[model samples]
Target chain A: MLVAGEHVLFHRARGFGRDTHGASPPTVLRHSLVKRKFFRLKLQRERTFAPVRTLYNLNLRQSGKMSEKIVLYYFDGRGKMESIRWLLAAAGVQFEEVLLTKREQYVKLLNDQALMFEQVPLVEMDGLQLVQSKAIMNYIAEKYKLSGKDLKERAMIDMYTEGLNDLMEMRMILPFKKPDEKQAHIGVIQGKATSRYFPVYEKALNNSQYLVGNQFSRADVHLMEATLMLEELFPTILSTFPNLKAFQGKMRSLPTISKFLQPGSQRKPQPDDVYVKTVMEVLNIQIP
Target chain B: MLVAGEHVLFHRARGFGRDTHGASPPTVLRHSLVKRKFFRLKLQRERTFAPVRTLYNLNLRQSGKMSEKIVLYYFDGRGKMESIRWLLAAAGVQFEEVLLTKREQYVKLLNDQALMFEQVPLVEMDGLQLVQSKAIMNYIAEKYKLSGKDLKERAMIDMYTEGLNDLMEMRMILPFKKPDEKQAHIGVIQGKATSRYFPVYEKALNNSQYLVGNQFSRADVHLMEATLMLEELFPTILSTFPNLKAFQGKMRSLPTISKFLQPGSQRKPQPDDVYVKTVMEVLNIQIP
Candidate 1:
């Protein structure tokens, strides 16, 4: 038998208990036979019900519940969640932003018993839970149709997203290390970004205004966040790439993003701030 | 416009291409229209004409085309390609092994004008070029119906594949640096695997003989390759994970795989042995 919000499958010779129905067969064998018949019928019903059960349940729950349909559990700082939140906003979807304190509260969340990746931003949508920031962003882009409109666009978006992810992973080592080591690492990355990555981005953006195409996409949103981080965190480092700077400016000018950058809007900590503090101490830059 | 053995899709004139065929498009787009159209048609045609194209184009063009319909461009010893080759063989798929020369040839390939990522184990499936070993392995697994039967099972397979990839990226750093540094890095990874990864794997196995369901899938192939690499490349590192070792041994015992490992059937290097030799020496490992 198929329930309203669930598919109930009964195995062969197994049926709903007879006690609840107030019906009993004349004898044990007769009862068993009746149960077997019901079991077969219920199995048939389940086979028909299996495909649409979950979809139906989700629809029902979404329609009935006034609670937030999507909740993104993350820290307020940009680090990982910036691109995802941007993507969700771009999609025009309504979602709850559950912010956590960066240092202690965030670590506690990672240690939570039910958390999958020991990280954030974790996105819960319609009951499905997704970890991995990139995966979550992609899922939201997918659900809301904010990803590119064609196959090539999606692949290109994927390529750029993966590339940015690689860059982010490399950049992450900067903040959690010693001063000298951090400077050396940043120098290597800055050199590479100028000579290697910037060229790729420049060429990618040359014929088209955006990274993938003329219209903006999740890839653009991701690039926007990454470029914003780079500009605020390592301004002088990537100054050699004029095209990249211009691209960053163009992204920031978008009305959707410009509002977010208004004066007094919260700004995330950039590695550059940390670098500056350490370097000033090393080189004796006075505090005025 | 749909073709057999092909997941063909045509974007309608709806500005955003709507797939008229039954192909499932990914949720995001990030490519220009020109590139998007090219890949869509190419992927569609490749599926339909792969066998024919391989016989005439790739196989006839290369000397060893007669050996295997699937040619995996790899190195002499173990690296990223091992898992891919293992997956193909485990799936009972016949493939030609094209080993490149290590120092001169491998470096040349990396510096190839057309190459992306400067790496190998590029799988030539029926003449279509597939880079990224994980993507290639996935293509093969999906085509052969060896990934998983259901959505949940497929997601689990993806989880394991992604986890192994994360570990592999860390392990790759070992060959590019000093021995002490390499050992320290290996120690960190080993600790994490013991404390984090191994437990996850153990729970997934949970007394089951296979990773996904009753039958062997690409997850098993990946597990086999990862375990073998850990044991052979970083001996004593995986000794603590007895269950993982047992699982590898169990995978090796499969008839399809066991046949490949039988005496004299092992493949060799073409001209890339020198680079492999240098890398091995740098890592302080003797070639068997």
Candidate 2:
């Protein structure tokens, strides 16, 4: 696939490979043949005038394959953007993370008329600035075939993903909450809500190794991120649900996921609590 | 198509048509021929084990076609189920609504191990009991080709739908807010958040008649629902955006949408406040 004058190849089991041939690129093969054998090579070559144009061209490269440039813009926190980061890693999609922390940059991004929502975890991919985390996640899932085995499976995955989102929403606290209130809030989330939700997950995991199906899907990935989050915020929360604990262990042990989570690996940890930092360190996500 | 002993024909423009020819059913033609010209008739002949089996066997139905049986389970309220109801109505898919109001039924459903999440808004169709409003909506969208023209268009639709969902989440009231603080809370949401977010939508509407594309897609349907909710909650909110107002009028004016919104139509308004009641009445949605 020729993208931005660069020859890129996407291997199924392996990550992206680049075969830069400068101006005189190698003769591209029919994308159909490549797709049948290797991966779904998406090539974006159009220079459209629209602010967002996510067009991809699929040809071939003689050597290895490379993906289009993906830059993830987010704050220096593992809040809403962590799942997206994890999704990129799980999909083996090569991306550069731009951790924006400065107040000036926030003001600039907010004032920027081009940005639809002026929000982050904004994914700049294939010349389109994609907003909304779930949208980005769904896009990656489709592109990588991480959605599900079938339509019903995909819908079930969506259900589980939305459930995880709801669980996260239940844990939120007001910014004006006093230190004591914060403790009480966490207690409420961990004791009541988490206790109620985790068992359902435990029951599901007991039935199948994964959340949706036999294979690891985007739902499992999302569940993993949310689970880690809960664990970080309230340690020993998952200890009661043995199946959920097992599920977490199984998910983290995946080669791609483990590699991303590994302390020495490339995934740099954003601003989080002590527990999250510890989890990151154990998982090999660098604590910045 | 042969569903049970009855031959059902599903017409595109018109709803289902039933030609129940007792034991000696009419000569069944191959489904492919019916699909090419007359209608996209889905036939399920399998006498499967499931309690609900959505099956259709097509023969010569003289008048308009008929579809398989669909059961929609939700509360009497329109909270999350209204969009699903709208989609079903728009698709012209014949469905039976099982609105559960009793706490005993709720407990029974919760205990029913068949339910994945033990949640309402469960759609029993095609031998599968589907849950989650968005998931069900997507399923119906795909079934009716309301998703989009293609994959990219579908992704765009997903983006806009998620965008609308984000807006809804932003409008939610924090549980901990005091009675006095609630007014201030609404003020911040309406003032700072709505001001910052709504212009992007206005701009998008100005660019196109619908949210995703020229044609009315699922995204437009979702956006319409959310826009109405906002309008109901905060009267005169859309006065600033003429394009959006026009878009709402245009969407509400659509045949299927207008039919769904009509007061005398089959749709009965779910439990909501006086504000929502007024908006529904103006939109021709019955305030039941």
Candidate whose DockQ is highest? 2
CA lDDT of each candidate? 0.48, 0.52
lDDT per residue as tens, model 2, A103-170: 23333333333235544556767555676666777788887888788888888888777667555543
Model 2 DockQ class:
incorrect
- What TM-score between 0 and 1 does chain B of candidate 1 receive? 0.64
Query: How do the residues B1-288 of candidate 1 rate in per-residue lDDT, one tens digit apiece?
Result: 101001111112110111111112211111112244453344321121212222123434345443336666554544556666667777788776645433333333333322233234556664345654544665677777776786556655665665565454444434432343446445645644554455667677778888888877887776766665566556775676667878878877899788766665442222143653544332222222
Badly placed stretches (over 4 Å) of model 2 are A1-67, A169-177, A192-194, A233-242, A266-288, B1-68, B169-194, B233-235, B265-288
Stretch of 10 with least lDDT, candidate 2 chain B: B1-10
- CAPRI-style class, candidate 1: incorrect
| Strongest candidate by lDDT | 2
- Tell me candidate 2's fraction of native contacts, as a decimal between 0 and 1: 0.20
Measured on C-alpha atoms, candidate 1 has an lDDT of: 0.48
